[model samples]
Target: MNKIYTGILSAVCLDGSPPAYHYAKGFGEGASNWMVYLEGGGWCKSEDTCYSKVQNQGPGMGNSYKKGNQTAFDGILSPSQTMNPNVKIHRRGARVFKAIMEDLLAKGMRNANNAILAGNSAGGLATILHCDGFRALIPNAARLKCIADAALFIRGKDLPGAADKRELSFATIVAFHGIDNFLPKSCTSKMDPGLCIFPENLLGDIQTPIFLLNSAFDSLQVSSCFFQNLLLELNSYILCIHFRTTLLKTIPEDHSSSRGIFIDSCYYHDQIYFNPKWIGPTSPKLNNKTMSEAVGDWYFDRSSFQEIDMENDFPRDCTRDT
Candidate 1:
């Protein structure tokens, strides 16, 4: 594992801070494969929030953040170590992502046998937004795919914040991260920047092979108190399940036909990014397959898997209560 401070400085952090990423060189059987994982931290809706995020995260990587813990990779990012969920959040996501991919290209990543661009949470969304650019950079690779973990957040009219607030929040992120410029032209040409950045509206346009690794019951979408209130009145919480179902509907018809999903009936956000939620006998299971098994099978094409635990093992709203 090596830490590379990007020499290409044009790409700065999301908050105008310095951009950087840690690299773990693949070896032996994996040497010919390139896996670029974008670190995930939730996005900031405004300059004020972005600034605050930087201040909190900057120190975690500094004096107290641990110069000794070199193996920071977790889940699919690296096979060596597990990431602590409490790790500091870096708000300069878009800049750091661009810098890393650019740096990798300069270092011969394009010659790899195949490539996997994966991310968690907000980084998952970044993976979606940058899927095409990644493939184009290494068009010669045998296969180039993208994986997004717990990144499918509901946006637009369906967002919990309502239309007006959602518009302001999305607009701020687009301006803050310069996301509008990368949005699929098909979406942006018809919708405003705010609406175009939402995945539900834009995922249909992504051409690169993508595998969504998220939970059917992503707790972050709605607060627990709110969900509990809904259950108190609506015995089934059908509305919540319906919303979750719609998010999965973003997958293309072709992908759906082939089968590459690990969505489960877990009340968590990002299981693939952390070990505890993804591994072990007691972990959430879909058709008896763990998160890693499903992802591996899909990325390597070992098996055809399309699992929606909500529809099979778990009863409707069972996850909402869990």
Candidate 2:
């Protein structure tokens, strides 16, 4: 674990602990390439929940003290050129990102040839929220892009014209975290800051190239909508269908060629960090290419991948052991 011990950057986490990240330097042709992955652990929308997460998850989640001395590089961080080809925290996550990037810039990332910023779940949402800013940080890199895994959290319409409970939750989080000040001005200027937390609101303004990896039937999102809306078991199937349709419609129609998307039919969430789901035998594929392949191709400009699995309109079980 590389802890940031320099100045104010040291105490950036919610608990005022030093924020840290694990680094695995590259070799050969991969030396100039950099991959910055932001980890996800669902957010705490209230102070009570924040305290609970700090206690329950220990220093590993928001504090660097308990982090391991070393961690194996797996999944997208794999060192194998054949496998990886390339390439957390806090209620104060926005600050954590800044500290990590500053540390990297100081430690030789300024000469990076190519760079990627990626994350899953809440981290995925962070990737979306911080996409353009991350690129601006490494303006010298020849190529820079972002990847969001299971990060698309929409303010879904569980019932016709019903108030969206999910939006309210996001609003609470935004207000609690004091994140309105950090949201993109382009989005906040046009809509409520709470809405900006949703990728649907921020996607249009992001100037950097990005690859989106999401399950069309994202299990966590679907379940959250079901329970929060208080839908009866008899109407659960109808809620599923409606939420799926809403998710599909919410994705913007206008996408430039540089953008990439891989929305599969699996009822899963956060696939990028798991070897089995990212590139192994059970990895979900579209156009006969796994998620890792598609992302690599897009990053290297080998091909454009914008395919969505239209094979099934509803969710299907494509679960794989990690």
Candidate 3:
């Protein structure tokens, strides 16, 4: 955590504020095991969006100046040995990723025996994007894997010939962030770098094992509508069904046997490490295992979880009150 400066690495935020992170060294038997979590705060596809974000949120999301000096660690990143173990920023996120890992290696991640790179939403996409590169960074580590939670933003036709807003947004983000160079060459070599940002386009080539925790009816990608016209509402419902089907089919057939999938029919976005959604009874379950249980089982090689919620065609409310 020392001897590395944001100014030296130029890993500053969009507003040029210094980047920051909350890290707790693992203790007891879990020492030498590392979990690198990339916090997701969506993306800024254009200059206007970025500007609007700055206006509304100050530099909190894009700058470390507003971030708390210490963040509470719970769930997977928790220091509780009995419960279990593990565990931000910028359009300059790619740069920040590199700098953080460099610092962690200097701080002892280089000695890591087991490592998991996990992220949610946009950060989950980042996990998939950088999985292989992260593996290469620690070749000596005995075990390394990645997890992408609710980041499987697919590219597909909403209607017969409708333009995909998600894909267009990604293209704009590429142009806005100038992050084309950071995209995986395996994907870029085959098509436009902008298309490569989609996880579906890049998953086929990823060497590192990855576990995907997502929802068939992802709340972010699919929205609820209150239409007065019955026909319009019916049309919207049909589109939702098509979207769900497209997402299911887009996930590869798991030919390599290295992918761990858990796509429930929940109306949630990011559901990785939060206590209730992660491990409690109210948490959405597939094959009798909660998200946290499934992830732990996959990470430790206890079992391979690759089940989709075929029963529910609609998104079920799985959020907990607490």
Top-lDDT candidate index: 2
lDDT of candidate 1 at residue 287, scale 0 to 100: 81
Question: Pairing residues by index, what is the TM-score of model 1?
Answer: 0.77
- State residue 322's C-alpha deviation in candidate 3, in Å: 15
lDDT of 1 by residue, 150-250 (tens): 87766525535556555676777787666676678898899898877677776777787787777765766644412434644766556566656665675
Q: How much lDDT does candidate 1 score?
A: 0.66
Model 2 stretches with alpha carbons more than 4 Å out: 6-10, 58-91, 158-164, 228-232, 320-322
lDDT of 2 by residue, 210-261 (tens): 9999988788877664454434455556666777787877778655767899
How does candidate 3 fare on TM-score? 0.84
Worst 10 residues of 3 by lDDT: 81-90
Better of 1 and 3 by lDDT: 3
Checking candidate 2 for backbone clashes, the offending pairs are none
- The residue-by-residue lDDT of candidate 3 on 48-102, one tens digit each, is 6665565455432433223334548877875542235111224676676788899
